[model samples]
Target chain A: MDSQITLSVNGTSRSLTVDSRTTLLDALRERLGVTEVKKGCDHGQCGSCTVLLDGRRELACLALAVARDGVEVVTADGLAHDGLHAVQQAFLDHDGYQCGYCTPGQVCSAVGMLEEVKDGHPSHVTTDLEADVELTDDEVRERMSGNLCRCGAYAGILAAVRQAAGA
Target chain B: MRALDYLRPESPAAAVAALVSNPNAKYLGGGTNLVDHLKLGIVSPDELVDISRLPLDDIQEYDDGGGPGLRVGANVRNSDLAAHPVVRSSFPLVARALLSGASGQIRNQATTAGNLLQRTRCVYFQDATTPCNKRVPGSGCSAREGYGRYNAILGASDACVATHPSDLAVALAALDATVVLLGPDGERRLPLAELHRLPGDLPNLDTTLGRSELITGIEIPFSPVAALSTYRKVRDRASYAFALVSVAAAVHLEHGAVRDVRIAWGGVAHKPWRAERAERALVGQQLEPDVIGAAVEEELENAASGDENAYKVTLVRNTTVHTLLQLAEGHR
Candidate 1:
């Protein structure tokens, strides 16, 4: 038997009817028809299903749709209304992706990564924890490694992230 | 994967009740582990008790309480715990390990309890076509002599050879943390070092946790050496990579002599290898490369490395030596 799941997408809240086994990725791509939330491996191994859950990047493939009742989910489609987010615009300008399959996840993940930096969150690569972290290629690459672009546009993606971060 | 029921429990007690009420209930934390299993058909639970709604997100030190230095909640995300003030200040080994192992996206979602309960990344187990002891009990491990690249070296039998993949668990083993389990009766604590068991004859039974039990949190005792801790991982890829061999080392120096030491290895055993045998050799001894390497080597001398994974022996040695040296150097 299916159950009722309430979720907030972008600024709109909806009572979604879904199965317990429906992944958040499936709920977005199939049920809600938000194709921007891509599904690559449908596993945690690939970050293609990355989405913003309460402003934090999480694997939609790993999340069950039914359990996330009061959660606010933001996808790439919902990230922008007119043109694009700074990171998305930077990605397009720098050619961060070729096939564009993993770009949504990459951009969403970057948003969360940038938030982490702004919150003074230290990464493993951050040697001096108390020092200011520059979002260099190494930092961006390390942070964005989860979003795998099979076209191998890592340099461009790193450049995009760096440019977006005011490099 | 087939469809099932799901519920986001409000508290640990509710999660426990959900599991107890339903024989086919499994608690979901990060879903990085359980969801993967669900898709792979390795497990098919009738219901999933969502533990993410529980009030388990915390990382604390019990110094004022005169207890162990650290306690990590089960629902605590790996990234949050890794970046927490207490963890960064007191448990750098764990933070370093967490960051080194997973990609930033995954680290943000993977929780401490889920990471601990994560199954092996054995090709056979994931494939499901082959006979595997972990996937199917008494089904004969295919990795025993076939493509055993990441198989266990320390704890292995004719049954299974899959090594636990979570690099963070290795640091917890070194920290000597205690896991808090919530069940029908109440809560019970078990040492993190004692959580995982060697896959002797029962490859399916990885830990002592029961079906009705939920890992509520992990409590770590305070250690003066926590500040001087380090984690070193060697893998194929630079990031988002599983460890070929990883080491977590922490040391306390008192007048040039090692007053305390904790060393653990990942991708070496079915569980995180808590090298207490090696740790004992460092206690009261000077932190020398040769001495530390010798001590670390003593713990792995009996390791039965396969033909495919023979390089792990050298890999483990190098990581162990490097991590120990880094921890020692931090003191100076």
Candidate 2:
């Protein structure tokens, strides 16, 4: 069955006919020509399709395009057009990427992670609830464990998130 | 790659209507498991019904605040349920088990009902080409003699050996939880202990759930047994891995004697096994080293293990005793 969805991509909004089964990742790349939403595992494992759904990081591959009809999807490219978001700048400064495959997801997830911290959402390592958010190495590790880096860019990603979070 | 039909039912009645008529329909919550299965072609639903909008997100009262525990909705996220004030105070075992479960992303996307109702993650079941009794009953279990070190021990038949993958269910079974079901007929609830069945007779049907029924909530009755409750998982890795042998144990001490004791093991059975015989053996007996050891030993006397799974017997035993003793000591 065909369903029409209107998604606000970056700044503009577009309406398109999409299959109910088509994932946001597929819709972004296939229909909208937004290739920035990479399809890594396509099963929510690799986190390559990480995007900000209404300003919160979510795996686009795991989300149905039909379910995201009215939601705003902010991808990695949404953060910066020419260069990068502050987090991405920190990543570039920290040499946070190797093959650059998982970098976009990492940056997008970090951007979300920082917001989560700012919103007082605690992680497993956030033992003291009364204290301000601490983006320690362990904190970043625990928070960013969702996105896997096959190229072993964890140290760089950690630095990137740490710098962005002002740890 | 298929264009599927989509329906968003705003109410539970509407959701049931969508489920009743469309045999090819799937009720989606969080889409953590179903979407992955859809991509893998393990389950092909021509119609996708979004049940996430239903009013099943609240955590209600279950066994009263004094004794019996709380009721969690099917739409409750694992992350939220784990961090809920009542959950964190009343049943840390559930929270601990959940926190140790899938990655934060998956947990945020996974719902309690979906997690409890999730099928086994056996490789064969995931691979459509492979033989899986759970996937296609009577097709034969490919993991019986295959890479089955992680399959199951108790209540597992030769037909199937897949284990229930929910970590919270183990703790819930130990706490004497109940599964509330809502269907076309009406709402009915089952003691969580009765939710799962042994794979001996019908390896296909894992739970006692009806086709049109939805697991509305899990009601955990509070018991003093788990004042020192804990979940110990021995997995392939420290994090982001399924357990090889895990034990959720609860013990109540009265006059320094083992009172109402409950034990359940995940990754060790087709269902979350409540060790009744073992619990009986432990009760009325002093929490002594020998008494506890003997009880644990008696439980595994009939435990059948293959070449690679024999270690699970020892692991379950040691882990059980250690958890019981630790909780027991906490009282002192």
Report the C-alpha displacement of residue B231, candidate 2, in angstroms.
2.2
Model 2 chain B, poorest ten-residue lDDT window? B60-69
lDDT at A73, model 1? 90
Off-target runs (Cα >4 Å) in candidate 1 are B63-68
Clashing pairs in 2: B68-B222, B69-B222
- The reply for model 2, stretches above 4 Å from the true place, is A80-86, A114-136, B1-3, B62-68, B254-256, B284-290, B329-332
What are the Cα lDDT values of the candidates? 0.84, 0.80
- Tens digit of per-residue lDDT, candidate 2, span B89-200: 5675776678667766677678898888777888888998988887777788899878977778777788888888888888888888888888899888798888888888
Top candidate (DockQ) = 1
Judged by DockQ cut-offs, is candidate 2 incorrect, acceptable, medium or high?
Answer: acceptable
Clashing residue pairs found in predicted model 1: B68-B221, B68-B222, B69-B221, B69-B222, B70-B220
Model 1 reaches what TM-score against the true structure? Answer: 0.96
CA error at residue B315 for candidate 2, angstroms: 1.7
